[model samples]
Target: MTRPPEPPPKRHGVLRLWHALRYSWDGLRAGWREPALRQELVLGAVLLPAAWWVGRDAVHVALLALSVVAVWVVELLNTAVESVVDRIGPEWHPLAKRAKDMGSAAVLLTLLASGGLWAWSLWAWWRG
Candidate 1:
């Protein structure tokens, strides 16, 4: 037998926007509660204003800010992956370990990129 059609998605407008914002805030709060996420957030808080000061122009500022944000984004994704893996079970499975390790590697790479970008901007500012 054929399955019934799925219901249409809810309409998009002001109410939807509000819900999206609320959900985003909830996620931020959840991230903040996590120790590693909290530390990264504090680091971002410090680096953001410093970026404004160190950047020579809007482009430079954007680059620096985006890099920092990218790291945070990757970290959040990594956290999500780890959470899911842990939820599945506490067993020492190879696939689970691999997934967590890959997520961690992603976060590490993002951090390295952010650091490199900031360094490049600082070097340019110092030279000019």
Candidate 2:
């Protein structure tokens, strides 16, 4: 006899929230596990608020906030890329190193862009 198909998973609201929290907690844990990430988080937290204060209007403040968030987003993506690359090969590999380096470069680009945005906005506000 043929076996029956499996039942669909439950979609309770509380359970969904719990799952979301679990994922967020996992990401937070991973971020804190790295010293670089911890430093980045501290820097972003300190800089974004100052940027907001120096921003003349809501638009500038919003742009500054988004730029800072962009940095963190890229870092998260870089971490994920590194994790996957490591999983694919436990041993040392040149290609894996290249992949990680590219991810780090992306994060660097994001941070540089954020710094540019913050500096330009603050400078304009200061001069005005």
Candidate 3:
């Protein structure tokens, strides 16, 4: 027998916002629990303040901060992908490997982009 499809859950106004915040907090906690994510969070803690000190102006500071945050965001997403893939099974599979590898690659690209932005900002400041 065919089962009916589930209807979408409804959330309204303030309640929706509250749920969103709660979900975000849960995600952050999960990320913090993950080793790689914990490391990135620590890195952000150090770099965010340094970004403010090293940046030349408000725009530079914001850019630096956003770049650092971007890395954290990407890392969290990568962790999510890995977790989901791992949950699927313990057996070896080409698609699982590809999914995990791609997630890692995404994190690497974000890190590289963030690093390049910071390096450029420093170079510009140095030249001034």
Candidate 4:
């Protein structure tokens, strides 16, 4: 006779939260392990507060925070791509280099956007 299928596992609310926290911690640790991430984090910490100080309005503060978050988010994604690419082929393949370059370009775009936002905010604050 064929065995019956097992029931699906049930997750408690606390268990779900714990799992999420665990994953977040893992991601944080991974970021810490990467030199590039550390550099970005340091830069974000410096620029974000400076932006807030220059703007000094609630809306400006929020926008600055969002920009900083965007930079960190992109860097994390780029790191993930680099990690996966390296895992797939540790050798210096042209494709692997291209993948890494694309990730870097994405980060550059984010930085440019952040810079533009800061410039506009500063200009507006000075004018008004």
Candidate 5:
């Protein structure tokens, strides 16, 4: 007979939150090893502070900051995808190629949108 399925790890309330935070920190640490992610972080360092200057008000600053955050989110996910794909095998495969391409496409879309928002926000600032 087959054995019973194992239960999920039990983490409750504050413990769960702590684990989540730790995992997020770990992910960031791992992301630092990636060149593209490192560049995005450096870019974030500049954009996050610039948001305060480029935005006209609180909402504008928040939007600008979030837009930069969005790029980080997308890039992190892309890096995750690439890592998984590489882990599967070193040999070339069509499915692996597709997955990596899709991840890159996602990053490209996010970057374009973020750039557009910054451009529009800056133009608005320049007008006055």
Candidate 6:
């Protein structure tokens, strides 16, 4: 006879929040294994505090911080996509290539946007 299926996982209230946090932490740990993500995190470490100096006000400071964060967000997404594609099997597939390429493109776009924001913020701060 077949065994009974496991009960559905909890998905509400404080338990859910705790589980979500744990999952997010796990994701970060996985991301740390990626060299590109590690590099970005290192840069973010330096830039986050530097934002205090680069920002002209609270809003600019928050914007600066978020700009750095946006890069990490994209990098994590790219990592996830690459992982999934690689998991699908070692054999090359056109669609897999496309998906990976698109994910990379997304990361590049986020990097560019974050860079632009930082540059603009620095320029505005310096001129003042």
Worst 10 residues of 2 by lDDT: 7-16
Using TM-score as the measure, the top candidate is: 6
Write the number of the candidate with greater lDDT, choosing between 2 and 5.
5
TM-score of 3: 0.85
Indicate the residue-level lDDT of 84 in model 4.
Answer: 96
* Candidate numbers, best TM-score first, in rank order: 6, 5, 3, 1, 2, 4
What is each predicted model's overall lDDT from 0 to 1?
A: 0.90, 0.86, 0.91, 0.87, 0.94, 0.94
**On a 0 to 100 scale, what is the lDDT of residue 109 in model 6?**
94
Clash number for candidate 5: 0
For model 5, residues 1-128, the per-residue Cα lDDT tens digits are 99999965989999999989999999999999999889988998999999999998999999999999999999999999999999999999999999999999999999999999999998998997
Model 4 TM-score, all chains together: 0.77
If both were scored by lDDT, which would come out higher, candidate 1 or candidate 5? Answer: 5
TM-score of 6: 0.88
Give candidate 6 regions above 4 Å deviation.
1-8
Each prediction's total of clashing residue pairs, residues at least 3 apart in sequence or on different chains, is 0, 0, 0, 0, 0, 0
Provide the TM-score for each candidate, comma-separated: 0.84, 0.82, 0.85, 0.77, 0.87, 0.88
Pairs clashing within candidate 3? none
Encode model 2's per-residue lDDT on 27-82: one tens digit a residue: 98898887778888899889888866887788877888888888888888899999
How many steric overlaps does candidate 6 have? 0
Q: lDDT, candidate 1, residue 69?
A: 92
- For model 1, the run of ten residues with the poorest summed lDDT: 7-16
Better-scoring candidate (lDDT), 1 or 2: 1
The per-residue C-alpha lDDT of model 6 at residue 21 equals 93
Stretches of model 4 off by over 4 angstroms after superposition: 1-12, 126-128
Q: What is the lDDT of residue 31 in candidate 5?
A: 91
Local accuracy of candidate 6 as per-residue lDDT tens digits, 5-118: 997586999989998999999999999999999999999999999999988889989989998999999999999999999998999999999999999999999999999999
RMSD over all Cα atoms, model 4:
5.8
* Segments in model 2 whose C-alpha atoms lie over 4 Å from true places: 1-12
Tell me, what's the RMSD of every candidate?
4.8, 5.1, 3.4, 5.8, 3.7, 2.7
